[model samples]
Target: MKKLHHIYIISAFLLSSCSPKISSLITKDYQSLKYDEKVVVLGLNEQQPANAEVLGVVKVRDTGFSTKCNYEIALDKAKLEARKVGGNTIKITRHKKPDLWSTCHRLDATILKI
Candidate 1:
């Protein structure tokens, strides 16, 4: 048990389990973007209203930090970039576990507009 506990603790520092890291944003291949519009952030369980069109997909890879707090920061960054592309809403598609030690949190969202 001691060895297991030590390993977990060590992982936190090495992987930044709960730390907030910089968000690596990906936004592209979007056509018909509406700029200067209000955007709504939605989680997986949340439902989006009617007549909304999907703008584009945005992926955020937040490293060093791997926690909800960090994801929120990354989400904020994603939203900011989405707005620039005229995204009025974002529907989070999926979240994945760390693919590697340095790359901690991975968030996938779909940008939408009405």
Candidate 2:
């Protein structure tokens, strides 16, 4: 029993240290953008383009066992989600850096078409 418990703990740790998680809520449907299409990323305080239209929201977070959710990676994932939802821009709504309880960056952004 002790050996099995140790094995489970090690397996969980190994898995958690492997991958981050990304999620999105798409409110409007549009033709998906091409892979090479550009998706502009805006900071939290940055103003969106005047012609912007809301598409949905996206979030990049660390699963309890996730280890690779750094700021750059999270931001990129958000942008990718935006493009998939046919958004031409993404405005960051929130950002949380790694802290005592978490070793990953978390991001939230609003997807838009401009």
lDDT of 2 by residue, 1-114 (tens): 999999999998898667778888889968889878988889989998888999999988888888678888888788888878789899999999999988999988999998
lDDT score of residue 58 within candidate 2: 92
Q: Which parts of model 1 have CA positions greater than 4 angstroms off?
A: 1-38, 63-69, 97-103
Residue 81 C-alpha lDDT in model 2: 88
After superposition on all CA atoms, how large is the RMSD of candidate 2?
3.9
Single out the weakest 10-residue window by summed lDDT for candidate 1: 20-29
Q: What is residue 80's positional error in candidate 1, in angstroms?
A: 1.1
lDDT of 1 by residue, 31-99 (tens): 434544566888889887678776677777654544554466767756766776667678888876556
Alpha-carbon TM-score of each model against the true structure: 0.55, 0.81
Computed on alpha carbons, the lDDT of every model, listed in order, comes to: 0.66, 0.87
